[model samples]
Target: MTLHATAVPFKDGASTLFPGGLPARGGVGLKPEHFREIIESKPDIGFFEVHAENYMVDGGPFHHYLGRIRADYPLSIHGVGLSIGGESALDRQHLDRLAALIARYRPQSFSEHLAWSSHGDLFLNDLLPAPYNARTLDLVCGHIDQTQEHLRCRMLLENPATYVEFAASTMAETDFMAEVLRRTGCGLLLDVNNVYVSCINRGRDPNAWLDACFASIPLSSIAEIHLAGFAQDYDSSGASLLIDSHGSPVARAVWELYRRAIGRTGPLATLLERDNDIPPFQALLAEVSMAEKIMYADAPRALSGEVCA
Candidate 1:
């Protein structure tokens, strides 16, 4: 059994990935540009996700708008920093700021990327990859432990869509993430788009990779799911590299993979992750509607135990 800090504890459920019933639909990275539109239109999206760092301000119009919206929407705090993959220790100052926001807003859920961003108090602002090994695994678990201890809540870690592999690596992505969950009581924020990007870039079968990831992680630990766009990269040697750019519309292959993930995870909290090249609010809402359609499209078949290949 898992341990909790207080007498009243995290609600026990079927799997660690999903502690309870998830809202099953949402939009990603709700920005200031759409704040007024969201309230005016009140798009039918189930939940709203925010970058935890964005709300770390003292007092401003941003917070003012966010407060108005917060009253209406179920919120999820997704952190881009925290640098769990860094060689050095996690940044306490950043974590303190995050904790303060959580206290103020009381988000329904919280998450951060598994990759690192800063080094030695300097912020790189890009999620960098980590080599999977026992040392790195231990380091990551320690960071997760510290984060949960300080924040006083369960957090989600996202897998990185990596470009390179280390020769000395001793574990696969699935095993590494599962180990972290087991050791630190943290949860997984499975990004289906990342899986698709990594599989295409690394020349692996996406389905096989998904199976490997699912085999390692217990579904109970999955707190949420992510879907985003990837940029096609070519180097000086003219080789193809897929980057998690989140700059375009959802790729066709990614949508198929998301269907597969939704099948396995079974209606977990889901988001459409767009950062750069974000179109009008309607375009994203269309994506949101598409995701909802896919998630509930074949409800009867899913109930009857019919699996799609």
Candidate 2:
């Protein structure tokens, strides 16, 4: 299942594929708590992203508000259950449902993680890591090809935040992701918090990791950015560990890294994700405002309609 044959070239950048896509600004994850407020107030934001799994059912309050909200803002559907990096063949039934959801909403962008979450029939509710080797690379690329072929739309592959490393892996995570994008022609959803979390856990400098990523991954392939909060913990070795908790406000260090990322990638459709310890809608909007300020402060050209090519 080599998908390179049907891979669409991201010649300029991922944004070029959809002219009327998400604006180059900040967005917040659409939670049920904020749905009513969003519809009533119509907050001035760049876009709204929702997890596809949450809206997989028919005729409910979720769809009721989402239908109304989608009309007013750009929507990005992020899938958490695709298991694109899994060893088994993709679940076609699940894919069909996802496709239906996309068709219903007609979101501006669709994305999934570069990690697997299921094995056999037992579905793990976590995004587990995969070994970065030749076999895993081929499997991931094939899955992305299948997803794109079925959805008839290019999807963004988000980098994962891992607390452990596979000793069997033969390539760096950044290199592996770069190869995946090259082989599949998919866009990237660069999660700055993930970078910081993974690096801090693995005893690497997040800034240097970002530098390495920029050198390998093209700026154009990066269609969106994700900022989230992480919980702090200590491993058995008494070393600091960062968890991708998404339970608090974006940290100061993560914000600094995001600034550096935007300076390089220019203004992208950035997302502020807070899945746990859910805060008030106004609090999330404040974080969104912070992200907007970083984008404009670091890349003023974004206001002039200049983005990465």
Candidate 3:
């Protein structure tokens, strides 16, 4: 089932239209609530990323407005249902639909999680963690190979925030992800909030984790950055737990971490993700503005290491 990497040229007019990829500025998650406003006002932003599963179906208003938005701004397709790490083979049907979507939109970039969301034909509807071991690594790499071959585009794999760690795991998360990137020729979509969440939940320092990641996977391999908010909760042992709820504005601490990340990655296409407790589009733009300011303004490299209030 291996497909060799060969160029699948973009549709004739697509190349002339979208001559460049997403800018290294900031963007927000594209929601139905903001479609009309976006179509009418045409907000100034770097790009827009949409969940591929949301637009998998054949047409209606979603495609109509998305087509208009796609024309004006670069689009990034982020998938939540690929189940790349699952033990089962990559779902051929889902891959076909994803490939069709890519052909239709010609997004500037595409990405999926490092975790699995399906077992058998049943989808769990959540991105669940996988062990950082030899077997899981092989499975994930194979899936990425399938996805890239079918879609004819490089895809970024995002790190996951987990509530529990697998005792059977034999490698650090960063090292595992680095290996995956090496084997698949894919890129990383460094999610600073996920770093903060996984570290805080597992009793580790977020800054140290970020540094470790940079040491293993060169910043150049990171194609995009994701900044989001988390909900705070507690475990039975009263240990602090952070949930990747994406239900609020990016936290102050996560913002500091993002500054550090971009200092190394240097203005990659950054996305602000808010899936629940969705606020007004204007409020989301304010956060995007903050990200743009950090990305575009000249700053010292040392500033990245320092997390200021």
Q: Each candidate's root-mean-square deviation in Å?
A: 4.6, 3.6, 5.6
> Model 2, range 161-215, lDDT digits (tens) per residue?
9999988999998889888988888988999999999999999999999998888
lDDT of 1 by residue, 1-309 (tens): 233232212433322222333476756568888888987987778788889888888999889888888788778889998898898888888889988887787777778887889898789998888888998998888888788778777788898888878887888788788778877777788898888887777678889988887887777677688888899987567877899998888999998988887777766678888889878988888888888887777344554554553
lDDT string for model 3 (1-309, tens) is 122243223332533223355778899999999999999999999999999999987889999989999989999999999999898888899998988888788888889999999999899999999889999999998999888878766778999999899988999998899888877878789999999999998899999989888888866578799999999999998989899999999999999999888777776788999999999999999999999888756345434534452
Q: What is the lDDT ranking, best to worst? A: 2, 3, 1
Clashing residue pairs, candidate 3?
Answer: none
In TM-score terms, which candidate is top?
2
Of 1 and 3, the candidate ranking higher by lDDT: 3
Q: Candidate 1, after superposition: displacement of residue 305 in Å? A: 12
Q: Residue 110 lDDT in model 3?
A: 81
Clashes within 3 Å, all models in order:
7, 0, 0
Which regions in candidate 3 have their CA more than 4 angstroms from the true location?
1-19, 298-309
- Poorest 10 consecutive residues by lDDT, candidate 1: 7-16
lDDT, candidate 3, equals 0.86
Worst 10 residues of 3 by lDDT: 1-10
